[model samples]
Target: MADPKGFMTTPRQDWPRRPVGERVRDWDEVYVPGALLPIISAQADRCMDCGVPFCHEACPLGNLIPEWNDLVSRDDWRAAAERLHATNNFPEFTGRLCPAPCEAGCVLAINQPAVTIKNVEVAIADRAWELGLAPPRPPDRLSGRTVAVVGSGPAGLAAAQQLTRAGHTVAVYEKDDRPGGLMRYGIPEFKMERRHLERRLDQMRAEGTRFRLSTAVGRDVGAAELRSRYDAVVIAAGATAWRELDVPGRELEGIWQAMEYLPLANRVCEGDLEESPLSAEGKHVVIVGGGDTGADCLGTAVRQRAASVTQLDIYGQPGADRDHEVEPWPTYPKIYRLSAAHEEADALGTAPSADADARLFAASTLHFTGDADGRVRELSLVEVDAGRREVPDSTRTLPADLVLLALGFSGPDRGDGLVDQLGLAMEPRGTIARDDGFATNVPGVFAAGDAARGASLIVWAIAEGRSVAAAVDRYLTGSSRLPAPIGPYDRPMVV
Candidate 1:
C-alpha cells in the first residue's frame, strides 16, 4: 500500500502540458519534457490503501492499479513497470490515449480527486525504457506452430507478441506501408510521438515476431491461402468502416471523413507529403461528431490554421459534475471535461464561441450548402432537446468551407475481401461474429478487438488481443500458459 495518510493529506497534481502557443506551432507531443517524473511519485502517493480497489475493476485490461501505485509511490520504478506490464501489453499507449475510466472508479474519487493513475503509468513506462528494465525476451525453443495475425493495430500486435513469447512462429500482416495501424496514420503526432511506437515495434522484431507490411490478405494473398499456410489466424483488422453523413450536399467537394483527413495529416508528418492537400488552412471548418475523433479533427484544424472551427454534438451538454443518482460511485459518468485539443482550440480563440470550448451541444445538421464549383460553403443545423427532437425556432446556418464527418465507425471494413473469402459470419451491425473464446465460425480462425467488438477504447483492444492469443495458443497446443484478461463477451465497465 502507498502512504496510508497520503490520500487525506495530498492533493492530486497532473503533469503539466506544454504551452498552447508553442505546442500548436509544431507537431510534438503536448507534454512538457521531464515534467512528469518529478510529480508522478507524489501523485502516486495519493492512491489510498483501499480494501477494494474499484479502479482495477474499471480497467478492461485489469491493470494492477493499486500495486503499481504503491510501487511507484515507493520510488520502485522497476517493480512498478513489471506490475503494470503483467496485465497491459502496452502501458505507454493506454497511459497516453485512454480516457482513464479507472480514475473514475478510484476509491478516493468518492469525495476527492482520484489518484493520477494515468500519469503514474506513463512515468513508469518511460522510466522502464530509460533504465533498461524493458528488454526483448525471445522464446528459448520453438513450438513448431505458426500463427498469422491480421492487422497491426493494438490487438494484433498484442496477440503476436504473446504468441511469439510462447514459442510460436508468429507473423503479423498489415495492409499499410507501416505497422502500428491507426497509431501510425490515424492518430496525430501531437497526441503521441511515433518514436514510442517505433521502439515497441523494434522490441517485437527482436522477440522474433515477424511483420509483413504492405500485404493485404484476401487481395495479395487469399484468405484461404492464409489459413492453409498458418496453423491459426487471428483477425484484428479493427472497425474502420466509417459512418457516413446522409444529409443533403454531403457529397460536396470540401467534405471528408475524419479518417480520410487525419491520415493525410499523419502522412504529412511522416514526410510522405510536404503538406496535406486537404489542409484546413484558411477555411471555416465544422466537425459533425461529439467523440474523441471529432476533437482530433478540431486539433488538426487548429494546427492547420483554420479560420474558425466548430464541433456539433447531437446530445445536449452534460453537467460539470456527476449526477450521483444516475451515475453512482465506481461508475464512469458523462460529465463535461476539457481535452487537450479543446484546450488548444479554446486558447487560440479558433472555436466559434470565445467563452466556451469548440463544441456546440444539441446541434443537429440538416444539410450542407455548396458553392458554384460544388464545394461545401455553409452548413444548416437546428438545436435539439434531450430526445434529439428539433426545438422550435432554433434553426441556424454556419459558414463551413470544410465539413468533416467524425461520426465514428460501425464495424470492420470488409473491402479487403478477407471476410468474403473466408465466408465469415457478421453481426447485423457489421461486426464479425465471434464466440466466447474469440473464435470465428470457421475453425482455426479467430476475431478480436474492434473487428469483433466494434469501435472501442485502446485498452479494450489490447485486452481482447491478449485474450484471443490465449485462446489461440490453447487451440494450437491443447494447453498454454499465456495470460488472458477477458473473454470475448466480457463487457466494459458501464452502468
Candidate 2:
C-alpha cells in the first residue's frame, strides 16, 4: 500500500499545465515541462490502495494501479514502471490521450478528489525512458512463425510488439507514410508530441518488428497473398468511417469533416506542408459536435487565429457533479468536464457559444447559408428538448465561414478493400464481427480494436491489442504465456 493514512493527509494535486498564452503560440504539449516529476510521488501517495480497488475494474487494460502506486510512493520508479508496463503496453499514449476512467472509479473519488493516476502513469513512463529502464527486449529465440498485423495504431502496435517478443517474425502494414495510426496524423502535436510515438517505434524496430509503411494490405498486396505469406494475421485497422451530417449546404467550400481538417493540420506539423491548406485563420468557425474531436478542432481553429468559434452538442449540458442516483460511483459518469483543448478555447475567448467553454448544448444544426462564392457564410441551429425535437421559436444563426463536422466515427473504413477481399462479417453497427476469442470468420485471421469494437478510448485499444495477441499466439503455437487482460467483448464501466 502507498500510505496507510496518506490518503487522508495528502490532497490530490494534478500536473500543472503551461500557461495558455504561451502554449497556444506553439504546438508543444500543454503540460508544464519537468513539473510532473516533483509532484507525482505525492499524488501517487493519494492512492488508498483499497481492498477492492475499483480502479482496476474500471481500466480496460486491468492495470496494476495499487501495486505501482505503492512502488511510486516508495520512490522505486523502476519497479513502478515494471508494474505499470505489466498490463499496459503503452501507458504514455493512454496517459496523454485517455479520459482516465480509472480515476473516476478511484476509491478516493467516492467523496474526495481522485488520485492523480494519469499524471503518475505518464511520469513513470517518461522517467522509465529517461533512466534507460525501457530498453527493447528482443526475443531469445525465433519461434519460426510469422505474423502480419494490419494497421499501425495502438492495437496493431501492441499486438505486433507482443508477437515479436514471443519470437514470431512480426510485420506491421500501414497505409499511411508513417506509423502510429491516428497518433501520427489525426491527433494534434499540442496534445502529445510525436517524439513520444517515434521513440516507441524505434524500440519496436530494435526488437525486430518490421514496419511496411504506405502499404495497404488488401490493395497493394492481395488478401490471398498475405494469408499465404504470414502464418497469422491481426486486423486492427481502427474505426475511421466518419458519421456524416446530412444537412443542406454541407458541400460548401469551407466545410470539412473533422478527420479531414485534423489530418491536414497534423500534416503541417509533420513538415509535409509549410502551411495547412485548410487553415482556420481569420474565419468564423462553428464545430458541429461537442466531443473530444470537436474540441480538437476548436483548439486547432483557435491556434490558427479563428475570428470566433462555437461548438454545438445535440445532448444537453451535464451537471458539474455526478448524479448519484443515476450514474452512482465507480462507473464513468456524464458530467461536465473541461478538457485542455476546451480550456484553451475558453481562455482565449474564441468560443462564442452559450457555455463559457464555447459549447452550446441541446443544439442541433439545421442548415448552412452560403455566400455567392459558394462558401459557408452562416449556420442555422435550434435548441432541442430532451428527445432531440427542436424547441419552438428557439432557432438561431451564427456567422460560420468555416464549418467542421466532428461527428463520431461509425466503423472501419472499407475503402482499403480488406473486408471485402477477406469476406469478413460485419455487425449491424458496421464493425467487423469476431468470435469471443477475437477470431474472424476467415481462418487464421483475427480482429481487434476499433475495427471490431467501434470507436473507443486508447486504453481499450491497447487492451484489445494485448488480448488479441494472446489469442493469436494460442492459435499459432497451441497454449501461449502471453497475458490477455480483457476479452474481445469486454466493456468499460460506464452508465
Candidate 3:
C-alpha cells in the first residue's frame, strides 16, 4: 500500500499550468517546468493499491500502476522507472498526451477523486532521465536472424527496440525524412518538445536499431524483395489517410485537411520553413470536428494570430462531470474536461462551455460558399437532433476565411502499394487484419498499431508493439522469453 491514510488525509490536486498570457506567446509546454516534482510523492501516496487494481486492466499497456505508485511514494524512482518500462515502451509520450483512462478505472473514483496517476508516471520517467537511469542495453549476442520493421512511429520503434535487445539484427524503414511519424509531425511541439523524442531515438540507435529514413518499402524496395531479405516483417505503419467531408465547396482553394495543415505548422517549428504555406495567420478559421485534432487546430491557429476560430461537433456536449447513470464507475466516460489545448482555447475567450459561438455542439455543416477565385469564404451549418435530422429554422452561416477539416483519419495509406503487393487482408474498418498472435495471413508477417487496429491512442500503439514483438520472437525461435502483454484483438472498452 502506498500510504495507510493518505487517501483520507489528502485531496486530489491537478498539475499546474503556466499563466495563459505567458504560455501562448511562446511554444513551450503549457505546464510550469519543475512544478509537479515538489508535490508528486504526496499525490502518488493517494493510490490505495487496491486488491483488484482496475487501473492496470484499464490501461491498454497493462502498466503496473500500483507498483510504480508505491515506489514513487517510497521515493525509489529507479525501481519506479523499471516498473513503468516493464510494460510501457514510452511513458513520457503518454504521460503528456494520454487521457488517463487509468484514473477513470481507479477504485478511489467510486467515492472520491482518482489518484493523480498520470502526474506520478511523468514524474518517474522524467527523474529517471535526469539521473541517467535509462541506458542503452545492447544485446551481447546476435540471433543471426534479420527483421525489417516498416514505419518508425511508436509501434515500430517499440518492436524494433525489443527485437534488437533480444539479439536480432532489426532495420526500421520510414518513408518520411525522419522517424516518429505522427509523433514527429502530426503532434505540435507546444504539447511536448522535440528534444524528448530526440533523446529517446538516440538511445534506440545506441542499442543497435538501424533506421533508413526517406526510403519507402513498396516504392523504393519491392515487397517481395523485402520479404525474401528478412526472416520476418512487422508493419507498424499508422493510419494516415485523412477523412473528407462530402459537402459542396469542399474542393475550394482555402479548404485543407487537418493533416495537411498541422504538419506544415510542425515543419515551421522544426526550422524546415520560415513560414507554413497554409499558415492560419490573419484569417477567420472554422474547424469541423470537436475531438483532439480540432482542439489542436484551435490552439495552433490562435498561436498564428488568427482573426477568429470556431470548432464544430455533431454530437451534443457532455456534462461537466461524469454521468454515472449512463456511464457507471470503472468505465471510461465521455464527460467534459478541459485539456491543455482546451485551456488555451478558453484563455482566448471562446464560449466557456460548449455552445454555438466557439465550441459549438449539435452542429453539422450543410454546405460551403466560395469566392470568385474558388477560395472558401463562408460555411453553412444547421443544428441537428440525435438522429441527425435538422432542427427547424436552425440553419445559419459563419464567415470562414479558411476552413480546416479535422475530421479524423480513415486508415493506413495504401497508395504505397504495400497492401496490394503483400496481398494483406484488411478489416471492415480499413485496417490490416491479423490473428490471435498479431500475425497476418502470410506466415512470419505481422501487423500492429493503427495499421492493425485503426487510429487509436499512443498507449495502445506501444502495447501492440510489445505484444507483437513477443509473438515474433516465439515464431522465430519456436518459443521466447519476452512478455506478450496483449492478444491481437485486445482493446479497452471505451470511445
Candidate 4:
C-alpha cells in the first residue's frame, strides 16, 4: 500500500509545464522534459491504496492503479510497467491524451489532490521502452483463422494486436495514406507527437499485425469479398463525418470544417505538405465550438501565426472548480478547463475578443458576411436561449477572415459503402448497432470502438477493441482465454 502515511507526509505534485510563451513558439510537448520523473516516485508514494480502489471502477480499461502506484513508489519500474501493460494496451497514448477519470475517482481526491497516476503511467511506459522490456509477443502458431480489421485507430490497433497474439492472422485496412487513423492526421503535433503512435505501430507490426493503408474496404475492395476472404471481420472505422452548420453563406471560401483544417496542419507536421491550405497565418480566425477539437484548432492557428483567434460555445461557461451538487466526486466534472492550448493562447494575449477570445456563450451563428471575392469577411451571430434557439433582436457581427466550424462528428464515414453493402443496422443516432458481443446482424462480422460505440475517448476505444477481440476469439474457437475488458453496450461510470 505504498507508504502507510505517505499520503499524509507527501503532498500531491503534478508534471510541470514549460513556460507557455516558450512552448507556443515550438512544436514540442507542453510539459518540461524530464521534469516529472524526479518527483514521480515520491508522488506515487502518496497513494493511500484504498481497499475498494474506485480508480479501477473509474478507468474503462480497469487498470490496476494502486498496485502500480506501490510498485512505482518502491522504484520497481520494470514491474510497474508490466502491471500497467497487463490491462492497458497503450498507456502511453492514454497517459497523454485521456482526461484521467481515474484521478477524479481517486479516494485521495475526496479530500486532497489525487495521485499523479497519469504521469506515473507514462513514466513507467517510457522506462519500459528504455529498458527494452516491451517486446513483440507474436503467436506461437497460426490458428488457421483470418480477420479483417477496418480502421487503424487505437481501438482497431488494440483489437488487431490481441487477435494476432491469439493466433489469428489480422489484416488492418485504413483509408488514410498511413495508419493511426485520427491519431495520425486529426490530432495536432503539439498535443502529442507522432513518435508515440509510430512506436506502437512498430510493435504491432512485429507482432504480425499486417496493415494496408490507403485502402478503403467498401470502396477498393467489395464488402462481400472481404467477408469471404477472412474468417471474421472487425469494423473499427471511427466517426469521421463532421457535423456542419446549415446557415446562410455556409459555403463561403474562407469557412471550413474543423476536420478539414486540422488534418492539413498535421500533414504539414509530417512533411508531406510544405503549406496547409487552411493555414491561419495573418488571418482573424474564429472557431465555433468549445470542445477539445476547438482548443486544438486554437493552438494550431496560434502556431500558424493567426493575427487573432476566438472560440465560441453555445453552452454557458462552466465553473472553474468541480460542481459537487451537479457532478459529484468519482464522476467526471463539467468544470472549466484551461488546456495547454488555452494556456498558450492566453500567453500570446490573443485572448478571446470582447464578446470574450470572442466567445458568445448562448450564441448561434446567423450567417456569413463575405467580400466580393467570395471570401468570408465577418460572422453574423444571434443570442440563443437555453435551448439554443435564436432570440429575436439580439443580432451582432464580428470580424472573421477565417471561420472554422469546430462542431463535433455525426458518425463514421459512410462513403466507403461497407455499412450498406454488408446490410449492417445503424442506431437512430447514426452509430452502428452491435449486440453485447459487438457482433453485427451479419454473422462473423463484429464491430468495435468508434465504429460500434460512436465518437469517444481513446481509452474507451482501446477497451472496446480488446473486448471485441475476446468476443471474436470466442466466436471462432467456441471457448477462449482472452480477457473481455468491457462489453459493447457498457459505458463508463461517468459517460
lDDT of each: 0.92, 0.92, 0.87, 0.88
- At residue 455, give the lDDT of candidate 2: 96
Determine the backbone clash count of candidate 4.
Answer: 4
Off by over 4 Å in 3: 350-357
The TM-score that candidate 3 achieves is 0.97
Rank the candidate models, highest lDDT first: 1, 2, 4, 3
lDDT of 3: 0.87
List of clashing residue pairs for candidate 3: none
Candidate 2: misplaced stretches above 4 Å? Answer: none
Q: Write the per-residue lDDT of candidate 4 for residues 1-495, one digit (tens) a residue.
A: 768899999988888899977887877888999898899999999889789998998898999999999999999988898999999888889999898989989999887888888998898888888888888889999999999999999999999999999999999999899999888888898878999899889999999999998899899999989999999999999988888899998888999999899999999989999999889999998889888889889999999999988887888777777888778888988777778887777667674453444345777788998899999999988888878888899898878999999898868889889999999999888888988888999999999998778789999998998999999999999988888888888777753
Q: Per-residue lDDT tens digits of candidate 3, residues 20-93?
A: 88887877888999899889899999999788999988898889999999999899999999999888777898
User: So what's the TM-score on candidate 4?
Assistant: 0.97
Q: Is 1 or 3 the stronger prediction by TM-score? A: 1
Weakest 10 consecutive residues of candidate 3 by summed lDDT: 349-358
Worst 10 residues of 2 by lDDT: 348-357
